[model samples]
Target: MLAIVLSAPVVLSDLYARRVPNAWLAATLLTAVAATLLQRLLGATPVVWPSLPGLVTGLVTMLPFYAIRWMGAGDVKFLATLGFLLGVRALLPIWIIGCLMTGVHAVCMLLFRLPRIAYAPGVSTVRQHLHASPLWQRSLHARQGRVGLPHAAYLGIAAIVTVLTPDLMHWEGA
Candidate 1:
């Protein structure tokens, strides 16, 4: 359930502007709340609430890119939501995997010279430029032509890794 919510934004964003839709975010948040409640009803012990930390970490890490116009607001929001849904224990591995996936995607894009597209700094900036720009614009104004790997895909991959290796987050100090 969490995985589904987390992955939806990535998939949707990839098809569009690598931006997570508001509907998706709303749905994910609702689902996460319900799931958490359900888990509690089922007698699952809560370790630590991870969503807040995950959101903070994601925002901090992605801020630079957002500032430089490298990523969209939706992407940042999606990552933070993913962190909240996954919680701290599971989120670490997911973050690791997501980063790895992003790196791989970046390398591939660089090699392929794929055009990258992103929203300019302000809403007004984007609005001002939209009329004058091509339908598909790169997010960054780089010499190699804008091309970037969809982070959502990597985020999904990371979620899968964490789900499969749930024990990885458990620490038993010997």
Candidate 2:
């Protein structure tokens, strides 16, 4: 519930602004630590260690993709934050399911846009296909084109769903 609540703004920001606010990410990290300590103090049953290793693993897992421009740095940081909150066991499943969801989201986007894009001329390459069409140009002042998946939003959704669904990812309180 905490993870989901924290991620809502992230998902909204990514959807509208194409960027996740750093403040939100920082808040998430602090909240994860504070939540863990509070849960412990409250004697929450089935408490799991907030795994720093899991956070590192999550960052490392996404670094190459960020380096290759397949994923954003913000998305990587977001996943690491989620890993810290979720612990290693839940983080693994969340990452896997998020990846799958991102793929599905990409395919659906492509399929939905295919008809609108098919008639555009000189769009022969993969890069051109992924970018804005000559037929429908954006203003110069508009933000730069987006490539690949908005994986942060997808990951946020995945994390929320994983945390909410029984037998998906085990939450400490669950």
Candidate 3:
């Protein structure tokens, strides 16, 4: 519930503006930390504490991508927030799945643009009629080959996937 509340606005921002808002990230981080502390105060064994190491690992792991200009600062921060939400134990798997999903998304974007690349660069195709409107339609149509994934959006999807397929990610205790 908290995850949905915190992430929805960030997702919307990423989809619409190609950016994540700092305010959203800060709120999410604070909420996560507060939740961890509150759980500890209630003697709930502090599941969030064990996950704390994920914050470091997640940030460190993603730093290279951001350094290379493959990812934005906001995206990196968003991923670290996900690390905190998922915890240390679930961090690696979640990150891996996110990466996989990103790859799939990239491939899809490429595939989507292939027809445009091959034939009418400026013309829309009958295929567009067959396919439902995709999330990145505005950016993809406007920019052509220069299109890039609003990668932060994929992280949100990865988080949802983690929740849905917890068994696959070995999220038993986490």
Candidate 4:
């Protein structure tokens, strides 16, 4: 619940700017820590400080994807922050859900633009078709491929949803 509520702004920001501001992330972290301290002082169950393994897990998991340019640096940092706030166990499930969501979005976009799809079973046939198209059409095709994925928005949403789902991954608490 805390994770979900706190990350709401992040989701909105990512959706808007395709970027996660460092200041907001840091402030959220600080606020979470302060809230946990207050909870402890009140003799409530203290929010578990996310473990070292969780932090490392987040970094190790996203680093390769970032290296390949599949996702931006903001997404990597967002995942790492999520790991710190949630736990190591939540990272992969959230990531998987986010990826599946992105895949679904891509499929829907493709379906919506069905006319743009050109199916070719063979590589030679693909080249032949490409060459057959006018230069203007080819340029138009290239430009259409530049849609931004805005992975951080997807990922932040996934993380929030994952936390909201009851007993997801059998988590006792974060």
TM-score of each: 0.61, 0.71, 0.71, 0.69
Off by over 4 Å in 1: 12-17, 35-50, 113-147, 171-174
Pairs that clash in candidate 2:
none
By TM-score, the better pick of 3 and 4 is 3
Backbone steric clashes in candidate 3, count: 1
Error of 3 at 117 (Å): 5.5
| Global local distance difference test of model 1 | 0.65
Per-model clash counts, in order, read 10, 0, 1, 0
Per-residue lDDT for 99-121 in model 1, tens only? Answer: 88788777754654433323325
Q: Model 1 Cα displacement at 36 (Å)?
A: 3.8
lDDT of 4 by residue, 1-174 (tens): 666765688777665555678887677678777887799899998777555567678878999999998887778888888888888888877888889988987786676455445342464466577678786365546434443676777888888888878466565655
lDDT of 3 by residue, 21-58 (tens): 78887777787778878898998876543355677777
Model 2 lowest lDDT segment of ten? 134-143
**Which run of 10 residues does model 4 get worst, by summed lDDT?**
112-121
Worst 10 residues of 1 by lDDT: 138-147
Which tens-of-lDDT digit does each residue in 108-162 have in candidate 2?
7776568556445643455465456652344222325655566788788888887
lDDT of each: 0.65, 0.74, 0.69, 0.74
